[model samples]
Target: MLDANLKAQLQTYLQKVTQPFEIVASLDNSAKSTELKSLLEEIASLSDKITLKLDGKDERKPSFALNRIGENMGVVFAGIPMGHEFTSLVLALLQVGGHPSKLAQEMIEQIQGLDGRYEFETYFSLSCQNCPDVVQALNLMAVLNPNIRHVAIDGALFQEEVEQRQVMSVPMVFLNGEMFGQGRMGVEEIVARLDTGSADRAAEKMNEQAPFEVLVVGGGPAGSAAAIYSARKGIRTGVAAERFGGQVMDTLSIENFISVKETEGPKLARAMEEHVREYGVDIMNLQRASKLIPAAEQGGLHTVEFESGGKLQAKTVILATGARWREMNVPGEQEYRTKGVAYCPHCDGPLFKGKRVAVIGGGNSGVEAAIDLAGIVAEVTLIEFDTRLRADEVLQKKLNSLANVKVIKNALTTEVKGDGSKVTALVYKDRATEELHTIELEGIFVQIGLLPNSEWLKDTVALSNRGEIEIDARGATSVPGVFAAGDVTTVPYKQIIISMGDGAKASLSAFDHIIRNS
Candidate 1:
């Protein structure tokens, strides 16, 4: 089904496969299986070193086993492996064919030295952007070592088992018959869990508690800065964060983040966390703050409770909970979320390479998405609701310079249109004439605005109508002994540098409060 260009690229990549590998399909004569079988045959035909074997009976929908000709590695794919999963299938093949994994040496050694036989069954949907990373990580480990084996299952195909196992989300992984996690996870994080042999401590919980003088409640750039600044004061500082790097992790290219010429999301996220790690701050990953309450009538200490029942006591608190992508709330948007609609372009852009895509919104985020996708995709259509583009002059100029990109203004995106399996098109209305138009495209990216992640802090702190926390010039909140910063606050012009500065200001404000009270 691949075009000539894609086929050529695949051949070039497959040339790196030095070892002979066999793909055994245990599929029925169903329509999905028929489609998958044809794709497999076409892929196998690309390289002389690869072979495809078909089995018509003894099946559960459409599943395949990847094995070396002379060896039984027990690696399987309990799904059709299309869409983004297509990338996973190719990477798995290359991994088996002697292509070295992108994983670090330390992680590889840990997987190699594992003691017992471990079997990982990961469930995912076709539209899940994060599924391939987890699957590829496990598959790489399995092909590299004999003791470990993995089966990446399509959740939709195996509904009966998924329901029985209570699998409710995409990329839900299980190790040795227990649930590992329910969201996107890094390879190193998973390896550390396996090393500890404790599924209970999976990136979601902080086992023990140590009181702190200052507690930072977010993990993004602002929260990191707040925690780092607080720790520098020689006070016991701790950070309780759901995930570090916050909204910055979803950002693709950060050109304006001072001193950094150009960098991707994941790279910048790692550097920000590494800088924090150099300090004495106690960081609790995967911890989301669920409640806030005064510790006692004295009001010296406050309690920050987590969703995991973990609690920490602190004399002061910094609310740096970041913001998230805003949705278009249009028709077919929710239905085709992963199928053809995506929010984090950086994470899912590669899956749409060479395809026609539409980006909703003409703001900096939307324009930047268009600029980034234009380079990889066949074409990019940017639709804005306003009459004029809202992106910075430089960004707009950069976007205008791209020949493959088209900018349409005064258009309201009314709906996202897609087939049952994936996105197919977009529907919009012209504001000037009220004329409705449809664009045939493979993907739609919604980047309208950002919503602050402060819903849980309701009734505890003052919040604006938009739900962002209200803070003073020094970043002090309405409540005493509590401060706020970042995009989560009433800060204007949400930027990484601005958030970091707000974090530093709030931290110093908190330290000043303590010093004066003492």
Candidate 2:
């Protein structure tokens, strides 16, 4: 199961384990046990010092325990570690089997100060990119204190359990059998939860957030960039976001951002976050914006509310909420998403190279995608629901120039056909003739128009017909003291570089608003 390079790396990492540790597997001898057993045995086989202990035929669900012979190190995996979460398992093994934690004394003390026994169960999926961050943080918390016990449940392996628990989202955490919360969380956030005397602690903290001179809603490149700029102004700045990275996290490869020749979405996202952290930005991450209330009276601060009942007041606000690709709610579309149905051509185009693929939508994105995919894929079928292509003339010309690309107008994508493992074909219906057609393709790229994440602000701020927040060149909205930027605004060409510039402008404008009011 372990490849030669990976095996060598694991063995090398395990060599640093100063204390004798056992990789224990508690199983009920079920089908799920078979898969986990194979991987565990393989890992244990690599190191002579490390041992694998099997507690077979256990009444409880399958779980992996990391510990010494008698003492339980407090880290247990209730699910198989695979997918994007695989790295968490590797890191956990090394951390649990090693010496004292490298965490600062303050952080260690914070974990130690927690009062009661904390038994955490985190449910996650393998494909979720944000799941590992939550799992790792909880696992580390457990490792630092014997009173803290964490169980990382792989949602895929424990489907029935997840369903029974009504776990609709990955990284859903349960503390002492009660739902804690969901989404990505940091170690400090967990500590905050523990520091809370009651379960409503998170809500209380949210309601008690300090007012900011500048509040940047959203944490994508634009929002992060805005927060950094605002923080640099020496003003009280805050940023609220569901996830810090936004669509940037979904991106795979980026080549046209400037300066940097090539990069990945998540990598760039990390850099953006690091840059923001360098500033004095009060980042309220994993907080979703639900509503916006304009400052009624002069000098009154505008209040921004979150889905979690968290609220922040700011004299000036910068709306940098980003955009998302519109999805075709067709059969097998969600099932095969990330498998074969991709939204970004630049991200997943290379994987479809030499394979037949279909590009849905004929706007600039669709035409551009047709041109981009034509160079890589064997055959590119560009489908549009309209009678004519809505893309720019230059893009249309470039797409037409490509021999391998074919454009079909007045066609609506009806279904994304897949074979459980991957996409195999695309189904479409001709709008004009009402003729249904199926195209054999390995990949389906949806290039439909992007939808701005400004629904919550539609009534509060001036919004365009397309649901984008309206803003002047200075990032000032129609409402005073409110600024809008990024794809959520009425900005042309919603590229990452442009959004970053927009964020900077919005932040600077927010600073200006503050000074003028002062």
lDDT value for model 1: 0.82
Task: List the candidates' TM-scores in order.
Answer: 0.66, 0.66
- Give candidate 1's error at residue 122 in angstroms: 10
| Model 1 error, position 242 (Å) | 0.8
Instruction: Give residue 164's error in model 1 in angstroms.
Output: 25
Candidate 2 matches the true fold with a TM-score of 0.66
Q: Candidate 2's residue-wise lDDT over 1-518, tens digit each?
A: 56789888888887877777888788775877888888899888877767888973333467788886678767888867876667788878777776565565966888877878888998876656667778888888887788999888876566667556755455678999998876567686688667764325545776787788988888898998899888888988888887788888766568998999998676788789888988867777767788888897435989888877767898998988798888899999998776677776654564454779888899977888789778878999999998999999989888888899888998888888877777788889989888899998888888898899888876678899999898898999988999988989888888899999999999898888888878
RMSD of every prediction: 9.0, 7.7
lDDT of 1 at 261: 91
Candidate 1, residues 275-339, lDDT tens digits: the string is: 88789677777678898886454466888878766778888889999998889988998888766
lDDT of candidate model 2 versus the reference:
0.80
Clashes of each: 0, 0
**Candidate 1 off by > 4 Å:** 1-184, 187-208, 259-262, 295-299, 394-404, 433-435
